[model samples]
Target: MRRSPDLHLPQATRASAGNLPAFLAACAVAVPVLLAVSAGNIADPIVRYDDYPALLAQPEGFWQKTLTEGRWLNYLWHLRGVVTPAWLNFVLFQILWGVTAAAIAAAAIPPGNRKWFAAVLALTLLPAPPVFLMAPWSSTLIPGFAVLALFAGLALVLSQRALRLLLPVFTLLAFTAYTTFPLILLAVCLISTRQRSLPDLAGLLVLFGASFAGAVLAVYALNWQVHGVFGIPLDPARSPDPAQDLAELWSHLPLLQETLSVLLGKLSFQSTPVLLFHLGLLIAATAVLLRRQPLEALYLWTALWAGMALMTLQVLKLGVTIPVRAFHFTWILYAVLIVRAAQELSRSPGLPGRLARNAVLLVALSYLVQTAVQFTRFRDWQHETRAMAAAISAQPGPVYATGSILDHPAARKAGLHRASSLELLTGLQLSQCGAVPEACAHLPPRLSSPAPEPQPQARLERFEGANVLVFPPRQ
Candidate 1:
C-alpha cells in the first residue's frame, strides 16, 4: 500500500518551505556575483582538450546529429555559440554547480529540521574543497548542475502532493537531458529503496534506461559522422595497454594526494589544522551513521563501494588515477547520509544525545567556514584561465588546441587546427588526422594496430610555427 506524504509526518515537522527566503537570498547573491566577477576576467579557451576542441568546432551540427544520431550531439553546443567571457554567463555557470549540492542537502532533510537544512546549504556554498582544487578543472561547474538534478528528484519523493512528485520527474528529465550519470545513479538508488511505490519505481527505471540507451546511440552516431564508421575506428597510436597504463597512474597517485591535501588547507599535512577538522567531521559523520542512521549508513557505504568498483576499471583504463571526479559523486551519497544522521539526531530525546548532536553541528559549522574560505581560491584561480586564453589569443598565426578546447566555438572561429597532441600537429596533415583518428598509436595493440615512429622532437617542433596554449594541469 502507498503511504501519503502528509499522513506520514509528525505534526511539528517542518519542510524547507519556511526557510525559502533565506536560501534563495544566499543563492541569488552568491551565484550571480561570483559569475559576474569571473566573466569580467575569465576567457573561454575551449581549444586545448579532447571534447573541447570538437564541441567548439561544431556545437550545433554536433548536437543535432547527437539527438538524431545518439551521442554528445554537438548540435546544441554549436547553437549555443562559443561560450565567451560574458561575465556570469557560462563561465559562472560552472561555479554554480555547488548550489545543487546545497539544494540536495536541503531536500534530503525534512523541512522540519531547519538547522540541518541550513547546515547543508551552508556547507555546499561554503567553499571549494580539495576535491575541486588541483583536480580535473571541470569540477568548478559540472557537479553543481548534477546536484541540482539530484535535489529535484529528492523533492518528488518527499513531496506530500501528486503535483510535487511530478516536479521531481520533470527535474530528473531535465538533468537526464543534460547529463545521464548522476541522475541514473540517483534513480537506481531511489527505486531500490523499500519506501517507493510501483509507479515511482517504474518511472525512474524507464527514464534512466531510455536515457542510457539514447546516450549510447548518440555516441555511435557521432562516431559515424566524424570517422565515417558506425563505431570509432581503433587507432593503434592512441591506445595504451590498460595494465601498463595503470602503472603510470599509480606513480602519479602521491602527487594527486598532495594536491588534494593542499585544497584541504595544507601546504604540508604535518601541522595543518584544516586536515584535522575534516578528518574529525568524517569520523563524526561515520559514528553518527553507525550508531543511529544504519539504513542511510548502508546506502552510503554501498554507494562508495559501488562507485569505487565501477570507477576503478575506468581509472585503470583511462589513466584517471586521481579520485577527485569520483569524489564528486561520492559526496552526494555522503550528503544523503548526513541528512539521515540529522534525522536520527532529531529523533533522539535525551539531553546527552542532544548535546552530542550539538557538537556535531558545531563541527559541521566549522567545516562550512573552512569550505567558504577555500572556495574563494576558485574565484582567484579563474584568473589563470583568463591569462592562458589571452596569451593564445595574442599569439601570431592560426591557434591549434589539442585537448578539450577543440570543440569550443572560440577556437574553431580562430581557425585552429585540431590534433591529439602537439606531436600529432607536427607530424600529420589536418586531412590525415580528420575529426576522429583512424589509427591511434596511444592505444594498446589489442585495441588497435600500432606503429607510428616516435616523432622524437615533434612535440617541441610543432609549436615553433603555430601558437599552442597548454594549461599543463598539475599531476
Candidate 2:
C-alpha cells in the first residue's frame, strides 16, 4: 500500500514555544477535577445484580472468583470491596483515574505539535466518562486497561524503547484483568495508524500480537496451576462457526444497523443540547479535517472502523444483547478525533484558524459545565436510593419491595433505572420479602395482600409516586 501524504500529527506539528509544562499541568489537573465532580460519590451503592456475592462474599472467597472471572488486575482493585466497605475501595478508582489522566497527559502533551494545544485538545469535549466514576458495576469500568494501553501505545510512538520490552508485561497486567483483546488491539491500531511508513506499522502490529500472546499464555499457565483450568477465558467461548451470531452478514445487516442506532440513542450522558453539541462537533470536525487533510482524516476513519469491528465481533461472539460498555472507548475515540481536528485547525494561518481555535476552546469549556450539570445526576440517584434503602431497612417483616426507588419519576428523569431489591438492599441488612425472586430471603415474610401488617414494625412511606414499606430496624 502506498503511503498517504504526511500528517500534522504531534510529531510533525509541534511548534517550539517550548511551552510543555502549562499544557501538561492543565490536562493533569483539569481532567481529574472534572472527574471528581462528575463522579465523586463515595457512598456504597447497593451491590448490583451481577455483582451480588461480591460485597457479601468474604475476603477469602474473592480470590477464587478472580481466577475464573479473568481480569485479575481489575479484581485486585475489587479486592478492596470485599475486604472493606465497597465505597472505600471505590476511592482507589479515583486514584486510578488520577494516574490515568496524568499518564495520558504525559503521553499526549509532550513535544506536542500545534504550539502546546495538544494538551487541551486531548480532552476537547467530554473528558472522563461518568460510568467509570459511578462505579456501580465493575463490569462497565474497564477504562483502566484501555487508558493504560493508550499511554503505553503513545509512549511507544515516542520511541520509549523500554516499553517495547515492557509492553507485554504491562499488557499482561492489563490482559490478565480484562482479556487483553481490546486494549492490545487498540494500542496496536492506534500506534500503527499513526505511523508514516507501512513497514513500521507492520512491525508494531507484530510486536503487539506477540507481547499479548505472551501475556495470555502466562495467565493460562497460572490458572492451570491454581485452578487446573487449561484454557484462557477470553470472552465468549470461541465457537466452531465464527459467524454463528450473524450466520450471514447480508441477512443481519438490519440487525447491525438497529444495534448501532440504539447504542447512539441510549448514551446516558445525552440530555437535549448535550447530544446536539456532541454531534455538531463530530460533524464539524469530520468535514473540516477531511477537507483540510484527507490522509490524516483517513487515520481517524481507520481507527473508528477498527473500533466498530471489535465491537461487532464482541457482540457476535457473546451472542446476546449489546453491551453498553462496548461503546465506551469508541465514544472516547470520537472525542479524540474531533480534538485532533480542532488542534489541526488551530494551526491554520488565517482568521478561520483563529475562529476554529476559539470555537473549540469555547466548546471545551461549555462541555465542562454541561458535564457537571448533566452527568452529575448520578449523585442524586445514589442519595435518593440511600434514603429509600434506609426506610426499607427500618421496617419490620414482610415489607413489600416494589423495587420502587428506581421506578419513581425522579429516577427516570435522571437517566437512572434498575434498582433491583437484590442490589439495593444487600448492604442494608434488609430482605425483599420475595418482591425480588433473587433478593436475599434473610427476612422471609411475603406480603400476604400487598400491604404491610399494621404494627410498630411497619411504617408506610412514600417516595415520589411509589409506596415504600418501611420496617423498623432489627434489634
Candidate 3:
C-alpha cells in the first residue's frame, strides 16, 4: 500500500476504529467531572454577576433579548423554564463543551493517540484562578464557542471524511454566539488552508467569506428587529477615538502579562518551576518541528499569532481591564502546542525521546496537583461564603451590603471576587422558592479609602427595620 502523506497521522486498525466511540463517550463524562471538581463545590448556589441579575429577574425578557441581540440560539440552552437551579444548567453546558472538544480531538488525532489528546484537552479545561468557569454574563460563553469553532474548523480542514458540511454550520453558529469566536474560526481555516491545493484553498476561503457575511447579516437583521430599521443604537456618547484606544492598550500591557501567567499555570511562586519546565519543553518541541516539519511549525505559529491578535484587539476595543477569560483562545492554542509536541516526541526513540516524554507528563501532572490544591482552598472559601450568606439571610428586614468578598484572603488567593458570591446571596435571600423576586436591594461598590487606614470589619448590623452587611478586611 502507498504510504500516507501525513506524517502526524497513523493508520487506524479495525480494533482501534471500533473503540473510538466508547473512548469519546468516556471522555465526555470524565472531562466535565474533572472540571467540576476543579471548580470546587459544584452544588453550591449559582453564583451571579453583571447580566445575571437581569437574566434572573426577567427570564422571558432575557430570552427575547437574546433573540433580538443575534444570539437567539443560546436561549435554547439558557431557557430558565427548562433548566432549574442555574448551577445544574452550567454543568450540562460544560458536558456539552467536553463532548464538542472530544469530537474535535477524534477528528484531528489518530486513533492510537486519541486517549492522550483527550486527557490533555480535559486538563486544559480545568478552571485556573482568574479564568473562572461560570458564565454569569453572556460574553463568558465566548471561550466555549471559540474552542468548538477552532476544533470544528480544524476537523473540516484536516479530515477528508469527517462532517465537512457541518463545519461551516458550526462556525456560523459560533459566530452568532459571540463576535470574537468567528475570528478564531477564520484563523484556523486560514492556517489549515495554507497546506491545501489552490482550488481547495479557494473553496474554503469562499465558504468562510459566505459564513462571515451570513453571520453579519443575521446580527443586523436582529438589531433591526429590536431597534428600528436603522439597525443601529442611538447612543449619545461620542465614539471612541482610535488613538486613545491604542494608548490605553499600551497602558494595559501588564494585564496581558497576568493573563499569560495564569494560562501557563504560574499563579504562584511554587508553580513557577513547572511553568519554566513546560516552556522549555515547548521550545524544544518547536525547534524539532521546525527542523523536521516546517509547515506544521508555521501552522502552529500562525494560530498563536491569531490568538494574540484577537486578544490585542479586545484590549483596544474594550479598554485595558480585559478579563482573564478573554485569553481562552490563546490558552487553547498553548494546550494544543504542548500536547502536539509531546505526541511528536513520543514518535521518537532512544533516551532523549523518553526524557522529553517524561518531562511533558510531569508538567501535566504538576498542573493537576496545583489545580487540586486550589480547588480545595476554593471549597473552604465557598463554605465561608455560604455561612456568611446564611447569617445575613437570618436577619429580618431590608438589607444593604457593602464591601466585597473579594477583600477576603481566601477569595484574593483564588483570584476571585465577591461579585458572584454577593449576587448569589441576593438571589437566594430575595427570591421566593427558586423564583426571582421583583425588587431587591442592590449592593453598593466599596468606598475608596486612604492608605494606612484600618479596613472595616465585616458585620451584619441591624438599623431600624433594615440591616447593613459589611465584608470586613482579612486579618
Candidate 4:
C-alpha cells in the first residue's frame, strides 16, 4: 500500500502507561449514569424484538448457546441474568459496554488526560443522542459484543505474536453479533494512538483492514456452524436473509442526507439533531487543531465520512430505518470529541478553548435531556402496556386486537419499533397463538373442541409489520 504524505500520525507518548487504573476508574464513574439512562426498564417493559429474559430463561436458550453463529459472546453477556434480575442484567451490560468504550478511548488518547477522557466518554454513552440505553432485550445489548471485539483488536496491537494469534478466536466470537461500529471504532483507536508502539498512518489503515477481514472470515465460518448455512450476515439479528437488508441499504444510498439524519438519532421517539451537531462541530474543531499531527485529523475526518457510508441497515421487517442501538459509532464519535476537546483546551487558553468547552457541555446537557425524555417514554410505555394487558386478560375466551395499534402516546411512538408481544405484560398462562392464519380464523365450538393446547413460550412469531408490540417475535 502506498503511504500518503498527507497522513500525519501522532507522536509517541508514554502517559498511557497507567491504562489499568484509568480503565477501572472510568468504569466507576460511568456506572451511575448508565443506571440512570435505562432506569425505566428496571421496573417494566421490554422494547422492540428483545429476546433477553424470556428466551434466555429456557434451558437450551441464550444462556447455553455457545458457538452460536460465533455470537456466543452475546449469550455469555447475558449469563449474569441467570443470577441477577432481568433489569439488572440489562443495566449491567449497558454499563459494561460504556466502560469498554471508555477504556478504548482512554487508551487511544494522550496519556496525561486519558482518565478524564475515559470518564467523559463513559458519561456520554448512555445519555448520548442515540439513546439506545432506553431499549431493552437481547438485540440492543448485542452492541456490547462489538465493543468488546474492538477492545480485543486494540489489545492485539500491543500484544506479542502469541496473543495476537488469539485475535481470530475473539473475532469469531464477536463479529457475528455486530459489525457497524467495530470497524469505525478500531480506526479511531489506531489514529489516536500515540506512536509509542503503533506504526504510521498507512499502518493504521492496514491494521483496520486486517481487523475487518479477520472479523468477516470469522462470521463467515460461524454462520455455517450456528445457522447451518454458508453465508455472511454482517449482523444476523437484522434478518436471516442479510442480502435483502443490504438491498435496503443500497436502495437508500441515494437518500444520503435523510439516511444520515436517521443514523444521527432522528427517530420518531428520539429526536436529537442539536446534540449530533455539537458533536460534529466539536470533533471537526478537534480535527483542525490536530492537523499538525497529520494522521489524527485525517482519521477524524475519515471516521465521520466513513460512518455516513457504513450505515446500519434496517432489516426488511422494520423497513429502512435502522435502530438506535446500531449507532454505536456515533456514541464513540461523541465520546472521542469530548475527550479531544478537553485535551486541546488544557493546552491552550483563548476564546476557541471556551467554545470547545461550551460545545462539549452543551452536547452533554442535550444528551442528558434526551435521555430523560426517552426514559419517561419508557415508563409511560410500561404503564400503558400493563393497563392494556389487564384489559385483554379480563376479556372472554380469546381477545382479538380491536385495532393493531396500542392506545397510548408512548406506545404509538413505539408503534412498530418495540417488542414482540405485549402478552408478557398480560402475565397469563393462557394459550396464545400468533397471527391467526386466515384458515384458522374461526375456531371450533369450545364445548366440542379440546382444551386449548399450550403454545411454545418462545417469542417466535413472524413479524408482518402489523403492530410489532402486539405480535410475537420472529423465530
Over the stretch 168-279, how does candidate 3's per-residue lDDT look in tens digits?
6666577556555665564445433324454654565566667766776766787677655423222223232233555765766665666555555533324676557656
Q: Which has the higher lDDT value, candidate number 2 or candidate number 3?
A: 3
lDDT of 4 by residue, 420-459 (tens): 3555455543332234334224433321122322321111
Clashes of each: 71, 11, 2, 5
lDDT against true structure, model 3: 0.51
Residue 155 displacement (Å), model 1: 3.7
For candidate 1, the TM-score is 0.52
> On a 0 to 100 scale, what is the lDDT of residue 269 in model 1?
27
How would the candidate models be sorted by lDDT, starting from the highest? 3, 4, 2, 1
State which candidate has the highest lDDT.
Answer: 3
Tell me the TM-score of model 3.
0.70
Cα RMSD (Å) between model 2 and the true structure? 8.1
**CA shift of 401, model 2, Å:** 3.7
Q: Candidate 4's error at 266, in angstroms?
A: 2.5
> Candidate 3: lDDT of 356?
60
RMSD of 1: 11.3
- The TM-scores, one per candidate, come to 0.52, 0.68, 0.70, 0.69
* lDDT of every model, 2 decimals: 0.42, 0.50, 0.51, 0.51
